[model samples]
Target: MQTEKITSLQVAQRAGVSQSAVSRVFTPGASASAKTVAKVKKAATELGYRPNMMARAMITGKSRIIGLVVAYLDNQFYPLALERLSNALQAQGYHILVFTSSNAQDRIAEVISDLLDYQVDGIITASVGMTNDLTARCETAGIPVVMFNRGQDDAAVGSVTSANVAGGRKVAEFFVSCGHKRIAHIAGWAGSSTGRDRARGFAEGLAAAGMKPLAVIDGHYDRSIAAQVTRDLMARSDPPDAIFVGNDHMAFAVLDTLRHELGLRVPQDVAVIGYDDVPLAAWPAFSLSTVRQPLNRMVDATLDMLLAQIAQGEIAPRRIEFDGPLITRGTTLTPKGPKQ
Candidate 1:
């Protein structure tokens, strides 16, 4: 007969101790006598035994894990935020179990349920479409959930985001101050709160300055649509002389088409400004002017809010909104700021 593999029970038996004694010895920072720990380690080394986290959580009532759900990693900002969150959470002795999807909203409840099954201590959501049922499930699970860069219509949920509305208004004023008339807007995906807020702000800014865009088209926050909408705007009989793209990714497409396809001059024929001021916006080829969301600061706020809840183990929900800055560059007329 083949020799039976050693188990924790066998380790306890060999060490002449209770099963729970063997368990404490294997659990990090769990109270155990030095002699018992030494005995358990020796038996475990012989048995190639490892402690099971699910079993340990049953004993201790704490599972040191965070479930991170991000829907739009296709957007560079979400990936950047995810990386920062991973690093930040790891420093706090918590690890992320990532769950990603394009339209994660539909399956969000299912995903949260599965994460609960794994006994994660908390959750951070970057999915815009997260449903009310999922939010309710998270509430019932009694685990802290922080919505990152997105918010629910439900005021009860905790979240952190940039001041998109104000930023939109600020950019609109900047465009008018540059004396550009007949402006147009290449909007973000109307589905997201960020997009909606920015669009609303831009409109308010335009109205405040007594300046209205000649045309406003929904870019749907896609690069191809941004370029195509831009082309449509340019091809019109009374095309806009300036364009404010909802985000830098779409703004880049606007620059390419304007310069290469229609051969328009920047800030001369059609002044182009974008939002979110991603790293590539400063690229030598594009050098696009845009609004900045202070992504790192927002990430810090997300980490701070979530970690505070994790440490406190209970608290009222909180929200943080970071201020955005306008970054001037070659594409749009420079404001009274330091040149790039």
Candidate 2:
């Protein structure tokens, strides 16, 4: 037997209210009196009536869905950020539709096209790059795009990221303060702005102190690669006394390699520092010294930029960056008192 769908008209009749009143009750941001809301909800529950979001979207031309595209979630930082983004959007009566994309340009374009087909109100790209053509298509479709935890040269798109450069500099300063002469870096993927910025800042800081890195190698944001890089660095005639890794994900691998494979003592033979103070970094096993990316504030800023565009219709793009504090832990030597 086929069951027919219950319409809002039936609910309105049962609640002794107009169809529009029933609509206003169900629609987000729609105004309805308390009495009307109670009656409509009671009738809806009794009749098993639910508002059709698709029909509402067709009428209002707003799907109330935000498309979130991320390149990878293997990194602990991204999963945490994604959860926060989803929760914040849900609280605003908006739903998130997640999509994964490869770093390849074609793959990213294909993903954006699918998002456009869904008529998503806005798109947030995390750890992914957007091409100019895709950006133009989104602009033509009147869909706003925001970059989360990634940056691009496109001025048309808004972006929110931690002050990666400053974070990297802090790591260098801490290492120099500890009197480590030979310092090296296992950098993040050079293809990413976050990676490049951090490397640049670290170099600048070292240069300011009249010291240069012993070696700077691109880890490509891969654990295996970072492990191999650690081996290669250790094989050098004079190994670095301190190493700064791009992010905590790779840093964890470095720590494992140093301790288990190379029999090195942290902060004794070699000191390690990383970016993104992920939860695992705090564990006694790792106790990694790192720069903390303000995830909550970054998420808040991303939502603010995205919502403003959705409401205002094509406002000026904004680039927001937050500075993170360097957290010292077991992996790095603690300053005796204060720097001279």
Best by TM-score: 2
Error of 2 at 47 (Å): 2.3
List residue ranges in candidate 1 displaced over 4 A: 1-51, 335-340
- lDDT of candidate 2 vs native? 0.94
For each candidate in turn, the TM-score is 0.83, 0.97
Native-to-model Cα distance after best TM-score fit, residue 76 in candidate 1, in Å: 1.3
Tens digits of per-residue lDDT for model 2, 1-340: 9878999999999999999999999888889999999999999999999889888889999999999999988899999999999999999989999999988999999999999999899999999988889899999999999999899899999999999888888888888888899999999999999999999999999998999999999998899999999999999999999999999999999999999999999989999999999999999999999999999999999999999999999599899999999998999986556647
The all-Cα superposition gives candidate 1 an RMSD in Å to the true structure of 4.5
- Residues 1-340, candidate 1: write the lDDT tens digits: 8766667898898888999898778665579988888998988888877767676678777777889888766566777778888888777667789987555455766777788998898888884556777777877877778888777687557889889899888888898888777888888888888788888899999999887778777887789999999889989999888898988889988999999999999878989889877778888999988888788888788878777776796677877788888888998775445448
Candidate 2: regions farther than 4 A off: 336-340
Q: Which structure among the candidates has the greatest lDDT?
A: 2
TM-score of 2: 0.97
